[model samples]
Target: MSFTVLMYHEFRKRGDIDATSPSTISVEQQYQDALPKVLFSYIDDFKEQMMYLKTEGYHTLTLQEIKDFYEKGTQFPEKSVLLTIDDAFQSVYQYAYPILKELQFHAVSFVVLGWLSNEREYFDPSISKVMSKQELEEMLDVVELGNHTTHLHKRYPDGTSEMQATSLQELKKDLAECGEYVTYPDVFAYPFGIYAPKDIERLAETGIKYAFTTVPGVNTASTSVLELHRDTVTLGCTLENFKTIVEKGASK
Candidate 1:
């Protein structure tokens, strides 16, 4: 059976930004400029999308379920979808976690270990603060952590990701380092959805079993676990658009 995977990043809540201080004013300005960007989704819109999934009988697949689908040739319902949030943003813990918890939906949060802040803040748009380890721990009931890498979640001046620019050995080391902070290290979403064919061939050496990309499509038992596709849900994704995305690649 085929199933779709959805990707998300930072979330924003209206009226939640208190632009009182100079830092906050700058934060508010940055947020306003980023509103139309693909990576930022309004929290209310995100909630509506999750609600749609629940009402439409979409089952949020877990890590083990994905492993079975890849390794054991298992089949799951067509309505099954995997929800993933990248970057481990504090906004995810702030805005997305509550909605997922309330809906009893499970999601995977891919984190860059090097970027996690030691301190937690209620809101900080300027830094777009990463969640602290404490915040991540508290969401264990509804969120599973995945490795996005340790310090390689960046792009070079030439537009290649650090993942693409570095050698496989270095990449392996980074992945292992990130594993120390997370419960699951076998799954990864490519930094900037970047990788080379040789990189994929050697990913097994790093112990990554399943890897996701920005490429949009659905996955089936026959699909390669290392090259999984995901539909990125973004700022302007309407409810109708969401339905079309989730329904587009279902098995007949």
Candidate 2:
């Protein structure tokens, strides 16, 4: 059976319409309109989603578990799915963590090591709120922390790979240190869901077994671990959309 991996960002209660900037928007407008309402998703809403999935007999798997199941034919629960959160937003730790714990679901978090370490302070003031090292470490017991590079620049305006290789190299070193500090396996999640074919090869060299993308689709037995696809759950996605994505994934 195929497995669908759901990718999520901030789990806010209220929707933020202007949170993200478009490529065509001017820098000034980007600054002015970028700050959107932090939509708060009630804890109950989260529980309801999980309950619905469980009722439909969907099983959740961690990244490592997915690899093991495929490569080793390891026994996994029926109707399995994988849950992942990107960018290490504080709301993920604050709002999503408890609900996940209540549902007894395992999740993977992709964090930017530089943000957690406070090594670089320049960030979009609109979205500067990220989880710190201590906060992240505290939740390591429940969620798997993985690398999302130290600096998460998607690409240069010219579409050139900016700091991509260097960032991954530094991230490897930093994650090794973090593993010593937290004792978790070193995994990576590509930032902005953007990666070159070469980047995938480079990641494999770093011993990374799995990496996620923003691509919307289900994964099959033949899915490449380095280029794993994901279905993004955004503010605009309704419960129906979620179900449709899952159903379509199952069909694939």
Candidate 3:
């Protein structure tokens, strides 16, 4: 069966959405010149999106169901979606978790295990911060953890990812280290939506069944699970545009 995978990163309150400084300017931009188009979404918008899914009878797929869809060729609901929040940001635990738990919707948070703190850090609404291990644990009810990488969420001076610059062995070690915290050992999201062909080819050796990219499209049975597509949901997206993106590429 086919489904849309919605990718999210940072979250902020609707009041924080300043017309002058958009939500698109994330903390990552200080280090990197370019960031993903879908970086952050308004917390209210996020809530509205989740409510829409609930009211519209959208089925949120579990990680196991997603694996079965590719491995066993199993069928899933036509209006199915997989919610993935990257970076395991504290905002997700503070905001998204409550909305999701209230709706009983399932989601996956791809975490950079090395970045996860042992205790809650100082809150700065201007910047998205990584969640503490305790906060992450509290989110287990509605969020399944996935691997983003251990400490490879960053890039080198030349913009080459640590994942890309390192040897395959190093990459495996990083993934394995992150896997220790991930709820699903077989699922990963590429850091900064960047990956080489070799990452896909060798990831299966590390027990990863699927690796999601930042590419936008609806994923079908014919799609490669290794480089599955995900539509980035950003603050710039209108609710109408969101509807279109979610339903885009589905078979009529």
Regions of model 1 farther than 4 Å from truth: 15-36
Q: Rank the candidate models, highest lDDT first.
A: 1, 3, 2
The TM-score values for the models, in the order shown, are 0.88, 0.77, 0.90
**lDDT value for candidate 3?**
0.80
Q: Tens digits of per-residue lDDT for model 1 on 1-252? A: 888899998787755443332221112111211222467777888999998889988889998888987778777777888999987778888889999999999999998888776667676765466777788889999999898989887766576777877788898899999988776898989988888787788787889999999899988877888899999886767999999999876667
For all candidates in order, the CA lDDT equals 0.80, 0.63, 0.80
Query: How well does candidate 3 score on lDDT at residue 232?
Result: 90
Q: For residue 164, what is the lDDT in candidate 3?
A: 78
Task: Give residue 24's error in model 2 in angstroms.
Answer: 17
TM-score of 1: 0.88
lDDT by residue for model 3 over 1-252, one digit each (tens)?
578999998777867645355332233213333333348788888888888888888888898998887878788777888999998777888788999999999999998887787777765666656778898988898889998888677776665677777777887898888888789867989888887788788777777888999999888888988899999997766778888877764334
Model 3 Cα shift for residue 112 (angstroms): 0.4
Model number with the top lDDT: 1
Residue 32 alpha-carbon offset, candidate 3, angstroms: 8.8
Stretches of model 2 off by over 4 angstroms after superposition:
15-47, 117-128, 152-155, 160-186
True lDDT of residue 52, candidate 2: 78
